[model samples]
Structures are given as structure tokens and as C-alpha cells.
Target: MISIRSVGKTYRSRHGEVVDALDDVSLDVREKEFVSIVGPSGCGKSTLLKIIAGLVPASGGEVTIRGRPVREPFPDVGFVFQNAVLLPWRTVLDNVMFSIEMLGLPGNDYRARARDLIELAGLAGFERKYPWELSGGMQQRVALCRALVHDPSVLLMDEPFGALDAMTREEMGLELLRIWEERPKTIFFVTHSIPEAILLADRVVVMTPRPGRLARVLDIALDRPRAVEMEFDPRFKAYSEEIRALIFRPRRERVH
Candidate 1:
């Protein structure tokens, strides 16, 4: 489980202007729960994830995983960025194994595990290939395998599929769901796509614009093994409309 409390982040420009990125954002993620954060560009969705991952420090408040404060990158956490970020020179298998190498875990022990993860991500024979040799979707799948190769308890993904085409993005969404179902982990995914968030998460955390704050958290009561057809369901439409309103409604209307 994870808990984030009253967390805020601020950045100072060289010109001495202070820009607040996040403001008093708080949320809790239960074990093996899939939570997605959706917000406008620069709404601090990614910043919140970095704070939890300890890639960057929060200017105020705190973030903890299973009660321990996260002051630095924890071994139990895995990260996937918007890009694959693979070492172009390394083969796919080598890239996945990179986690073990970086973490100083037993490489011999995890080599088999790495191979299994590649297969799970549907990149079985592609392990011998390089990032440049694969399609964008395939490259992202490689990134996903690398994140899970070490078997981290928590996966932090930041717009992992944002670069792909619509069709590939949808396919990756389904691919991610399948992998999650087969091997559940506490996943916190950040994205700009509302539909992608709704399709993938058990709960969608909506955030306000600049100096982002939690606007609403909607529980997705959709059934398991969600198919693309479910998007046509009346309940899905209602959830989408409600979220759209929360994000796009006039500021005066949102004031409570």
C-alpha cells in the first residue's frame, strides 16, 4: 500500500519566479490496486509520480510506501517513462537484464525471469533485436518488460503509450491489462488521455490545472477483463461525461 499526504512541489526559475507544480495533493493506493491519474498538460500528474518514486523530492509533506517514507528510489519500485529509453546498443534481453545489473541483484538468478517477462510482454523471439529494430509499440513492450523484470512490488508509469498511434495505444492498453491480470502489482499510471485512464484503472484520479490539486477521484465499477466493446456501455459513457465535465467545466461552476 502507498499513502501520499498533503504533498506539494514548487520550482524556482533562474529569474527568481516561483512556480507551484503540485498543491496539497493526497491519495492512497491499496495493495495490487491499479490507479490512473488524468489531468491537463502541466497539471503535475507526472510530478506526483516522481515524488512517490523519489526521483525528485517534494517541497512539502510526504509520500510513503507501506508506512516507510520515500526519501530515495526504493528497490521495490519500477518506473516506465513516456519513451522506452532503452540502451540502443543493448539487445532486448540485455535491456531487461539491465535492471538486475543496476540493482546489483543476482544476474544469473534473474536471467530466466527476464526471459519469461519478455515472453509475457509478447516479445519472445524479439529479445535478440535492438530497440531501433522494433516498432514503437514493441519498444514500449520492451520497456514494460524491463520494469517488471526485477519483480518490483510497485510500478510507476508515466504516459508509457503516449507516443504510439491510436490503434497501437489501444492494443498496448489491452496488453497492459493482460499482464496486470496475470501478475498484479500496485500500479500508479499517469496519462493525459481520459479514456485510457478509464479503460485501465480501478479508480481514476482527476487533477485540476496548473498548481495541480486533486479535483475528483472516480471509482470505475466496470467489470473485470474489460473489452473495447465495454466502452459503448451506458455506464462508461456516463463516467466519461462526468470526468470531462470535471476537467472542462468553468472555474465558477467548480467552486464549492
Candidate 2:
């Protein structure tokens, strides 16, 4: 579980002015729950993810994973970026084994696990292929396998499928659901697509622009073990629309 309380981040510009990225963002993510954060660009969605992952520090407030304060990147959490970030020289298997190596495990120990993950990700026949040799979707699959190879308890994904084409994005979404079924983990996904968030997450968190704050938390009560067919369901569309309204609702002026 991850808990963020009164978290705020501010940076000083070259001119000595402060820029606020996040403000008083508070939320709790339960174990085995898949949550996605959506907002306008520069809403600090990525910053919030990084803060939880310990990749960045909050200027104020607290972030904790499983009740312990998050000061540094924990081994139990895996991060996937928009780019695969795979090494050009590393083959698929070697890439997936990178985390195992980082954990100081013997090569022979994690070789089978890496192989199984690669195969499970639908890259069994491409284990020997380098990142450059595969399509964009295949490369993202490699990144996903690499993130999950170590069996992390939490997965932090920042638009992992945003770079793919429309068709490939849909395919990857279905594939991700299948993967989630096989191995349930606490997942925090950051994306701009309402449908994508509605389709994948148990809860969707909407945020405002800069100095990002939580606008709303929406529970997707569609169904469990969501399949691709769920996307066409009316409930899914209703959820999407509900979030859309929350995101763009008209504001009223305050009277003095």
C-alpha cells in the first residue's frame, strides 16, 4: 500500500521565483489495486508517481509505502516510462535480467524466471532480439517484462502505452489486463486518455493543472477481471463520462 499526505513540491527558477508542481496532494492506494491518475499536461501526475517511487522528494508533507516513509527508491517497486529505456546492446533476456543482477542474484538463478516473463509477455520467440530489432509495441512489452521480472509488489507506469498506435494501444491494454490477472500488484498508471484509465483502473484520480491537486477520486465499479469486451459496455462509457464531467465542470465565483 502507498499513502501520500499533504505532499507538495516547489522548485526555484533561475530568476529566483518558485514554481509549484504539486500541492497538498493526499491519497491512499491499497494493495493489489490498480489506480490511474489523469489530468492536464503539467498537472504533476508524473511528479506524484516519482515522489511515491522515491525518484523525487516532496518539499513538504509525507509519502509512505506500507507505512514506512519513502526516502529512496525501494526494491519492491518497479517503474516503467514512456520510453522502453532498454539498452541497445542488451538482448531481451539480458534486459529482463538487469533487475535480478541489480539485486545481486546469480545469473543462473533468475535465467528461468526471466525467460518465463519474456515468454509470458508474448516475446518468447524474440528473446535473442535487441530492442532495435522489434516493433514499438514489442519494445514496450520488453520494458513491462523488465519491470515485472523482479516480482515487485508495486508497478509505476507513466504512459507506458502512449507511444504506440491506436490498434497496438488497444492490444497492449488487453495484454496488460491478462498480465494483471496472472500477477496482481499495486499499479499506479499515469495517462491522459479517459477511456484508457476507465478500462484499466479500479479507481481514477483526476487532477488540476499546475500546482496539481486532487480534483476527484472515481471508483470504476464496472466488474472484476475486466476483459476487452468491457470497453463496449454502457457502464464503461458512463464511468468515462462521469470522469470527463468532473474534469471539465464549470466553476462558480465566490462572493465576498
Per-model TM-score, in order, reads: 0.98, 0.95
Error of 1 at 52 (Å): 0.4
1-256: candidate 2 lDDT, tens digit per residue: 7899999999888999988999999999999999999988888999999999999999999999999999999999999998888999999889898888887778897788889888888898899999999999999999999899888999999999999998898789878878888999999999888988988899999987678898889999988767778989999988888778766765342111
Q: Which parts of model 2 are misplaced by more than 4 Å?
A: 250-256
Give the TM-score comparing model 1 with the true structure, all chains together: 0.98
| Model 1, span 82-177: residue lDDT tens | 988999999999999998999999999999999998998888899899999999999999999999988899999999999999999999999999
Q: How accurate is candidate 2 locally (lDDT)?
A: 0.89
Clash totals in order: 0, 0
- In model 1, residue pairs whose N, Cα or C atoms come closer than 3 Å (at least 3 residues apart or on different chains), thus clashing, are none
* Residue 68 lDDT (model 2): 95
